[model samples]
Target: MALYKHSAYVKTSTSDEFDKVYSPGASTPHSGIYRCEGCANEIAANQGNPLPPQNHHQHTSAQGSIRWRMIVYAQ
Candidate 1:
């Protein structure tokens, strides 16, 4: 993992669609595991129906760039 020390606020628009998600116990689990095609997130279906609750970002990676839009050079 790359270590970044800077953060910025983003005022942007995105068209990528996010798949529907459910809380740990919100979905009907099965005898097998289920994975998300979009982000590769997984649902432990073996944990029993409506698998144990989990955090949304638990199985995902955080993506963003920390770049300087305005770097003051010699004026």
Candidate 2:
């Protein structure tokens, strides 16, 4: 999870972007912390930038694909 000490520097939103999942190497829709659906690993990505490639990490057959979902929004 994304952590911060000062609440004044962060706030919450109800954007539908948070519900979307992305593929590896795809352009990010927003800048935020993204969690991998397969292994639960997290990465920070910026909008318009490509997400990590499939080779960025390894996963077992049971872990599935390296899908990404935004969990924290950064504006």
Candidate 3:
């Protein structure tokens, strides 16, 4: 499993001129929690932290253990 912290995530307000929105990242995060983009729930995480998903899942990047950090928008 990989590792990351809360700081790995970044937030934004709006999307592009069309429908596609993008956030650029040159490097991957150290370690943190990852949530499902579908259900918006913790699907995987590393270490015995307070984060949910009690156990690790097959979900994650193959490049390395990075935060799949979920984005939450305020309505």
Candidate 4:
């Protein structure tokens, strides 16, 4: 099998939602990073669930820009 770099963020509005997308002891390990559909940025993990709005930011990309945000979370 070929090794692929896994780099993606999980978007969720609530803790329950996050849990739904990711479960404990799941095969895919949680990167502790959550991406916001509003802005694309990397936020520090362990910031706690239901991350504060102040933690998000607008990330820029070559293909225009997106409002995706990210934060680290426990697995």
Model 2 / residue 49 / CA error / Å: 1.0
Please give me the total number of clashing residue pairs in predicted model 1: 2
Worst 10 residues of 2 by lDDT: 1-10
| lDDT per residue (tens digit) for residues 1-75 in model 3 | 233467445444464322322222312222333444323344333333333331333434543332235333222
Flag regions of model 3 displaced more than 4 Å.
1-29, 47-75
* Every model's TM-score: 0.28, 0.88, 0.22, 0.28
The sequence of per-residue lDDT tens digits that candidate 2 reaches over residues 1-75 is 667899998778888988899999999999989999999899999999999999999999999889999999888
Q: Is candidate 1 or candidate 4 better by lDDT?
A: 4
Which tens-of-lDDT digit does each residue in 1-75 have in candidate 4?
A: 112255553333565434433221223233455554443344333432443343234345643433223334454
Question: lDDT values of the candidates?
Answer: 0.34, 0.92, 0.34, 0.38
Consecutive 10-residue window with the lowest summed lDDT within model 4: 20-29
Residues 1-75 of candidate 1: C-alpha lDDT, one tens digit per residue: 112255343222332212333344544423434444334444444323454444344443443211111111111
- Those runs of model 1 whose alpha carbons end farther than 4 Å from true positions after fitting are 1-24, 52-75
Error of 2 at 44 (Å): 1.1
Q: What TM-score quantifies how close candidate 1 is to the native fold?
A: 0.28
